[model samples]
Target: MDALLSLSNDLAAAVERVRGAVVAVNARPRLPSTGVHWRPGIIVTADHTVRSDEDITIIAPDGRTVAASLVARDPGTDLAVLRVHDTDLPLADLGDPGSLKVGHIVLAVGHGPRVSWGVVSALGGRWRTWRGGEIDQLMRLDLTLYPGFSGGPLVDVKGRVVGINTSGLSRQLELAIPVSTVTRVADELIDKGHVSRGFLGVGLQPARLPEAFRRRLTGASEIGLLVVNVQPDGPAAKAGVLLGDVLVALDGAPVGATEDVQAVVGARRAGSTVTATILRAGAPAEVSMTVGERPSRRR
Candidate 1:
């Protein structure tokens, strides 16, 4: 009975410690404001949490509420950072997401007053958002997350944040982007004011070149992405990339699949030029294209 009491006390203390750093951010869209302690008086949340509004507040540890502003946001990863004018607020310690492994025990903290238990289900899980047509690597957890849980913290046993709870696929499957990915993109957003990524204005399809075409094309592959249509006056069109051209490589890396091209361009900075090798008219040729801004629809 004494040991049970002691363990209960320890658990209570741990919850208190996390709650101290956890804050209820009164953001638009009503997502659960799990808290973040990145810097003095600074907190991080999901980009979608505060993207559509201006007035925001952070519910502090001592039951104090303060106004805050959206510091930065990266739409690609759906992460955002917030800053409070006051400097005395407690900050949460960020854990290295690389340390997270599948089957590791995790605690999902949200605005409600308790930490929920779950286990990491998958790593490097890729999926596309309903709004943004891009692939984001996600960490799946075995928790039945709620709507307000978006942007909350996924902590380890020690109460260190390993990832930010982003979205859910089912009642039992929760998803999050690793904190390391958020940190990387957040750093860029802090410095550049936006997530810069390369874009090629062309819709592609997988195809096999005819035997005669393959014979003349040195780099043509029967199992690579082929350009079905190029957007008029867009990056690929401006670079003289024509329809039916087979994309062989980008920046010296082979692109065998449609996702490969998307991944390469999606990771590149906008306005930067990249070399693309293409099989055009049964001949291998190189083209230079300035990565353009992707349209909001991603079409």
Candidate 2:
């Protein structure tokens, strides 16, 4: 039918529109992935794809192979940035992924002619990645991400980029890092060598509150975090936090579990101050703690 023909034509046109920015990233052994020329001289790809930092190469759309240097990488978000010079790869034409709805037609475009088409299968609220990265929004696709497609672009019918496709973020399903999240992470990596996650050096376990206290703390969690260990000379200890204290809330938000605490702190930068409400010896008290930067990796 005419409708079918028009739709097919549009899809081909879409691929033609955005293929220039797509490049093959050879940072790993054997299995190469895709990358997008996100900004001038800046390439973005799945962090997991870049296994070797020293000898990374980028195969451009024009069949030009260029050397790339690792700018910074955040395994938490499965995103990495690489810098390339002496190339004029076009920047991706980005679109707002927030406008995507379930069942919308989409395309996954990789380097050269590699691509797959599917629909937006589902959408969810903010979620935390397996790597403990906080995603601004959850986007699931019903498309196939062929090998070497991990860092490619997911585009709309008109070829505007919606997100960066990646399988490293999730094991069982195909997902894309939304444009909003991609830009934010890329900006941070460009400004700073690493992504800063807020930290309060203390170990904690979840504990239920007494019924009386629970009723008093209405609109908050019935369970609170029991401080088990406070690192000496660390943020919590510096703020006079003791091991026996029960952390009931942070910045007026009740924390019921470790994840609740992580959700609050992960959004903040280092040097930010937060008010932690704690129960000391069965008496409620509050302390101001200055947030610290979590070490990117454990020693």
Candidate 3:
């Protein structure tokens, strides 16, 4: 009984410690999500929750409503940054998400200072989100993300934010974007006003190579991506990649699927270059292709 009481008190104290950094984000029409004061005057929220690019506002912890401007948004990672002025809300005390172990006690600190306790259910290495964002790490939690909690902070026992809670990333599982990823994305968004991803303009489909060709390309996979369409003047076309070329590998990594292509391109910046190994008419060749920025589209 004594242990239970102590634990309860500690959780409540944690909520109190993090309350000031949590704010109510009103960017969507109906449902308002939460936001955290990640840095001074910088609020981070879930990108999906920010339905409007203009006329956005946030309700601070003290019930003071303030106007916020949409700074930049990265839908691939489901994170958005908003800028506020003339507010003195406390910034989040962040902890290392890498230190989290399975079954470690965690808290979701949301707007209105709502709290839900849970454990770190699982951890995974580098992964790409369905929307093509490269996440540094995967942090899953066994907690209920209450309404308006999508952009809240996932706090540790010491009241330090370890991640940002979001329901927008997955349909079946609750996920928290780890602190390292959040900081990296947030910094990029703040600096460039948009996250940049390397792109190669080409339509490709998986094609199984002939046994003889597979043997020739010793380091590549049996299946390679066959170039069906090459955008005119695009990265691939500019690099002298012709149609009917089967891409065997990118930078020595065998790419059997589109995800594999993304894994390589996304890791590199727009101005960087990648080594593309291809089989042109059953003959292996390599092309040095400079990566291009993926053209931004209106959401």
Off by over 4 Å in 2: 210-216, 219-222
- The alpha-carbon root-mean-square deviation between model 1 and the true structure, to one decimal in Å, is 4.1
Q: For residues 239-258, what per-residue lDDT tens digits would candidate 3 score against the true structure?
A: 99998999999989899998
User: In terms of TM-score, which candidate is strongest?
Assistant: 3
Q: Candidate 3: list runs displaced more than 4 Å.
A: none
**lDDT, model 1:** 0.72
Candidate 3 yields a Cα-based lDDT of 0.92
Better of 1 and 2 by TM-score: 2
Write down the lDDT of every candidate, Cα atoms only. 0.72, 0.91, 0.92
How many collisions between residues are there in candidate 1? 2
Best model per lDDT:
3
Sorted by lDDT (best first), the order is 3, 2, 1
Between prediction 1 and prediction 3, which has the larger lDDT?
3
Give every collision pair in model 3.
none
TM-score of each: 0.77, 0.94, 0.96
| lDDT tens readout by residue for model 2, 1-299 | 99999999999998998999999999998988999989999999999999987899999998989999999998989999999998787889999987899999999998876889999999888889989887888999999999999999999999999999999988899999999989999999999878889999999999989877666665568888999999988899999999889999999998999998998888888899999998888878889999999876731
